[model samples]
Target: MNLSNSLDKIKTFKKVGQVADNLGMETYVVGGFVRDILLKRPCKDLDFVCIGDGIKLAKAVADALEGKPQISIFKNFGTAMIKMDEWELEFVGARKESYQNHSRKPKVEAGTLAEDQERRDFTINALGIGLNANNFGELLDPYDGVKDLKRKIIRTPTDPDITFSDDPLRMMRAIRFAAQLKFDIEANTFDGIINNAHRMSIISGERTIVELNKIIMTDKPSYGFKLLFVSGLLKEFFPEMVALQGVDSVGDKSHKDNFYHTLQVLDNVASRSDSLWLRWAAIMHDIAKPPTKRFNQKVGWTFHGHEDKGARMVPGIFRRLKLPMDERMKYVQKLVKLHLRPIALVNDKVTDAAVRRLLFEAGDDVDDLMQLCRADVTSKNNNKVKRFLANFDKVELKLQEVEEKDQVRNFQPPVTGDEIMAIFGLKPSRVVGDLKEEIKEAILEGHIQNNKNEALELMYKLAAKKGIVNNPDK
Candidate 1:
């Protein structure tokens, strides 16, 4: 395979090639850039590998670019980075690696291009496009990477066991690539992953989560998750999700497998939105069903309060997974807590009051919540699915009408603490809080209109009932 086309895209790359030739070093554009170029995929970030000093080549390339780009050198790793134009270009010296029994970090030594290919995690990533003048445009594919790329397969450049055992993070990367590219993992490589899944224990939660987030961000994220569950990778990182898998039966009746159901929901949400955490909320929406599962002779099986329980589990799950424990964590928690609200509207009468409360609680996320609820309806029966969908349409329309009329989303009570305090001439106390709650509930429940005057009047009545005198100034 020749890669003159890949080199042709970047004019500055030619200068580096000339500089490398002058310096007596063999340098090639290697790894993902080469793979993506042959696959006709768009990639801006480029990785270059050289047989000699990478820092020298990186400095040369930067210098060739009129010397303005910032070149960061890492002497310990024989690598350098430059943020040129729109992409990050990293240069590294070709090296061999030998890992320890207890750690993924390897003992590195200067080596040839073959050594670099051998160290690559996947065959597709081992392909390199030579930039040296003599072999310019020639693509080195010692591992048949182009063939594997053509077949849309995921296989390591070296033996799967050696690749994964050297760095267990490669296992996660393999699954992430397979999911993102919609490719099949080679049988031997997948088996090696399963065999070495336990080795992931040596990896840190932070490092593991980086690949986990990539898997979640894919178009069909559930595929990667299912692979993780089946191969026991998820159990090591997220036991809570794996716990949602099995079905519990009693007296000839069983509940839907919440684990697979969660995956279906995750896929459904992914089909509509690209938000990673919202998709996470879909995956964890029923995580507590197993603990809350119940069986009765009449109903067969039920998961009561699973939503509330799952919401409670969200903080713990985020903490364990190394996910953000701030607003993002709260966003997911909010979605999990309210996942069932819209669905509960489907089977029963879709009411304006119910929709208003949902809009009020969900606020700007009302649409995402509705999407999650609709995706939550994963019934196999055609009629049930159709019925739920039709009912959801009605619920959505009602929500729009209610939101437009009441403006209750992210609603602040028309009556403020100052107003309540002024009206009742009372200091900060339970009475003020009680009055605010009363005013907000009145607006939400439609007992009184969502207006300042109406709220003030309602506040007065409550204060009168509570035996508080009105402020003479008002």
Candidate 2:
């Protein structure tokens, strides 16, 4: 089918095609740009493959454009890129590839357009639209990519085994695309992923986590996690998450499967917010249950201290996965540790002191923590879920009330340690720290207002009880 009308809208396509025509090089807009056009997805990047020197064609096209935008050339890979007005255009020469058993990196050489299309990871991605003078906007679908796109299926252009084994990263890509597009992996393509799951060892943690994060960021990430679990790919990289898959029973009592529960919680959080780190907090909130799980005749099952344990586990997991060891990791860690706090308030009396402590600890993250806690309600009973959610609402209102009254979220002591030392004529010691702690606690407990006057009064009384008289004149 001719897509000339669509091509007409993108003026750069005509410029590139004219440049390639002048240079006598066959060129087509290929890969995701073409695929997204058919799918009607908003895309800003274009990938063009030419039968001749892509770099030369890139320079010619750059000069042909109105401003002669600067082009970046990768001579080693025979690829070039230029950015023009919210559009990134990439040019590459068509090439064939051969891979060794131990590496995913392919030995590349110049080849025909058909060879290049054959090497594509997925059928849909292999679809190309002509940009040459003669075949402008002509659809090229030698692998029936348009058909697979219509069916909403993920399939390889060639043998699945060859596709996956050559680059195991494609296995993750297959799953990511399926999750992102809400498409099903064709039977044979899925089986290929399961069969070559072991080959993931060759993939770097950085590369693997990129795909994993994309999957996690999807609308309903649980679907992707389930696919990863069933395909055995998750076990290859993240065994800790896989360990949460089963239920243990004692006589007639059994705990719900923590793995599926975590997924449900993830979906719940996803529905409420689009923050990736908050979603990550949901994934890790119960990650320690497998190790901390215990059977009790009275309670049936308990994952006591799982929150604290899971918080401790976050650093090591982040280190291994090559995730940033910055505030983002600490944010996830803090959320994991405090995930049970708001729930405890919902179960208990929702005291001002409890709310103060939670607000102080969670700081600016208090709202996100509440969101995670709300998502953690995964009971099957509708009444229980509704009751818990209603109680959470009450706890949230109390939090807001207390925060407005006390201003304890990320609160600092009204009296500094230096002020205490100077007021009491004492050197820096444990006594100064103890005095600061007392003031902070008294403010949080509502025993004293969080102000210099009330804090100083409490400090003087505590010091007098300790037989230390205030000597501000000293």
Best by lDDT: 2
386, model 1: CA deviation in Å? 1.5
Candidate 1's error at 404, in angstroms? Answer: 2.1
TM-score quality measure for candidate 2: 0.96
Q: What is the lDDT of residue 67 in candidate 1?
A: 50
Q: Which residues of candidate 2, in runs, are more than 4 Å off?
A: 347-350, 421-429, 463-474
Candidate 2 C-alpha lDDT tens digits along 92-116:
9999999999999999999999999
- Residue-wise C-alpha lDDT for candidate 1, range 266-360, written one tens digit per residue: 99999999999899889889988888888889988888999899999999989988999998899889999998788666544556678778888
Instruction: Return the clash pairs for model 2, or none.
Output: none
lDDT of each model, Cα atoms only?
0.88, 0.93
Q: Please provide TM-scores, in order, for all candidate models, with all chains considered together.
A: 0.95, 0.96
Where model 1 places Cα greater than 4 Å from the true spot, the runs are 346-351, 422-425, 470-474
